[model samples]
Target: MIVAIIDYGSGNLRSAAKAFERAVAEADVDARIRVTADADEVAAADRIVLPGVGAFADCRRGLLGLPGMSDALASAVLEKGRPFLGICVGMQLMATVGREHGDHPGLGWIEGEVALLPAAGEGLKIPHMGWNDLRIAAPAHPVLAGLASGAHAYFVHSYAFVPADPRRVLATVDYGAPVSAVIGRDNLVGTQFHPEKSQATGLRLITNFLGWRP
Candidate 1:
């Protein structure tokens, strides 16, 4: 499989590449992964992985400035139905708006907004860091296949996704309240937690994504 890791200059490019590398190593298939700024590579890839780490607005601007990269991604995933997996802030960009940089518009692939994680009672950590359990939603998605409930995964973020459609949320994790953890709609998949850092379970999720038919 050929997986193109979208590079817009704001993502954890090398780390994301390594995660796929590790996952592919465990899987039965041969995978070719690349870190490219080329839009054509994105359009031609079998699957596209979008990873981000930083403010939503800045990342959005970087992607927009990449000439045809943004449109190519949208076309590949939205119109052509190629598999898409977004990680960390990459998942946040799929939402409609984010209050992080004063209400900037997101990719709007999913109807939602990104906001600060609500404080726990009064004084709580802002960026809910460290390992947390996933509350996998029912019917059991292929991404979550073989994964047990309450599976611990690494998380490090302040802003959380607030999905407008509850049905779109695949899994959630609690810090103070339940935050959306995994999201899948047709060919698009997203994770608020860092699957790259989340050990075995996380690596398994990446493996599933790479071998996933849809």
Candidate 2:
């Protein structure tokens, strides 16, 4: 399968590519993971992975700046029903709106808002960085197949995704409160944490994603 890891100048594409490479090496899935900013490649890929860094608006701008890339993404992941995986701000872009810097529009793939994490003071960090335990909502989800409730994943973001539908949240990680860690509806799945940096748990997720049909 052709798995495209989108390169829109807003993420650590090489590192993400390496992570996916490692996962493909360890797993039995025959996936050709390529990093590209080409809209044509994204639309034709069998599986698509979007990795992002920096502010929500900036990332969205970078993505939209690539002419035809947005429409290509819509066609591949939405219209064609290809499996999609979004990481960090890439996942945030899936929300209907983002409150960071200002009210900005998103892809609206998932009915939700990306807002700053509420301050529960008393030394809790704003970025919510480092490793956090994932509390699986349901182990039956294909991408989260083998993940346990306490499986740890690397996170480094201040904003959180509040999905409109509760059923869309597949897993959460406690910061000041339960934050969405994994989310999905149909063929679209996203993670708030960086699976490329999550070590074993991340690799397992990558492997699962490679084998996941939807």
Candidate 3:
């Protein structure tokens, strides 16, 4: 099996690549993981991972700046129904629009808008850094297999994706209020946290994603 992690000039590509490598090895899956910006490679990949860090508009611009990259991704994930994963800003990019630094267009794969996290209460943070517990909304979801509700996952983000349809939310985290932790629909899945940096929980999720048939 071939898994392609798209490096669109954002995020810690090396870290994500290493985590995926470790996950596949531990799972005993014979999968080749490639980090590339090439549209052709992305199109040919059986599974696609899009990892991003930094501003939403910058990430989106970086992705679309590559000639034919967006089209290739759409054809592969949307048209062909290949399993797709988005991490951090990559997840936020899946939204229809982002309100950070003014209105910006996203991939529109998921109907939502990226907005700054509201203040939960006194002593709370803006970036929402550190470990947070996950509440699995869809326990039977393939990507969430073996991951129990209330499992702790590392997170670092200021903005959150508020999906238009509540059914799209697979899991949540309480940061003064409920924050979308995981979102999925059909072949598309995303996490607001960096699964690579999430330690054991992250590794298990990665392994499950590698083996997911959808």
Candidate 4:
């Protein structure tokens, strides 16, 4: 199996790559993982991962900046029905639109909008950093296998994806309010928290993803 971690000029690529490498090894899966910006590489990948960090518009621009990259991604993941995962800003980009730095168009893979985390009360922060418990909304979901309702996952983001349909929400975390932690439909899945940085819980998710059929 081949897993492609897209290098779109945003995100901590090294960290994500290493985590995936370790996960594949631990899971005893014979998968070749590559981090690349080449459109062909993305297109040929069996599983695709899109990781991003920084502003939504900037990340969106970086992704589209590469000629044919967008189309290649669409063909591989959307048309081909390959299992896909997006991390952080990468996950946010799957939304229909993002409100960060004004409204910007996203991949529209998921029907949602990426918006700033609403102020919970006073003393709550904007970039909801550190570890938080995951409220498993879809316990039977394969990507969330082995993860319990209150499993702690590390997060560091100010904006969150609010799905138009609540059923798309796989898991949530409580900050000032209930924040979407995981979202998925069909073969696509995304996590607001960095699974690479989430240690055991993150690795478990990664392993599950590697073995996930859809």
Q: Candidate 4 — what's its lDDT?
A: 0.93
Query: What TM-score, to 2 decimals, does candidate 3 have?
Result: 0.98
Candidate 3 residue spans exceeding 4 A from truth: 120-123
**For residues 161-188, could you state the per-residue lDDT of candidate 4 as single tens digits?**
9999999999999988888999999999
If candidate 3 were superposed on the true structure by all CA atoms, what would the RMSD be?
A: 1.0
Superposition error at 7 for model 3 (Å)? 1.0
lDDT by residue for model 1 over 55-139, one digit each (tens)?
A: 9999888887897988898889999999999898889999999889599999999999999988545377988899999988843
Q: State the local distance difference test value for candidate 1.
A: 0.87
In candidate 2, stretches whose alpha carbon ends up further than 4 angstroms from where it belongs are 120-123
Residues 21-130 of candidate 3 have per-residue lDDT tens digits of: 99988989999999999999999999999999999999999999988898899999999999999999999999999999999999999999999887545468888998
lDDT of 3 at 68: 88
Instruction: Assess each prediction's global lDDT (C-alpha) against the native.
Output: 0.87, 0.92, 0.93, 0.93
User: How well does model 3 score by local distance difference test?
Assistant: 0.93
RMSD of each: 1.3, 1.0, 1.0, 1.0
Supply candidate 3's per-residue lDDT for 132.
Answer: 90
Kindly give the stretch of ten consecutive residues in candidate 2 with the minimal lDDT sum. Answer: 116-125
Taking the tens digit of each residue's C-alpha lDDT, what string does model 2 give over 41-99? 99999999999999999999999999899899989999999999999999989999999
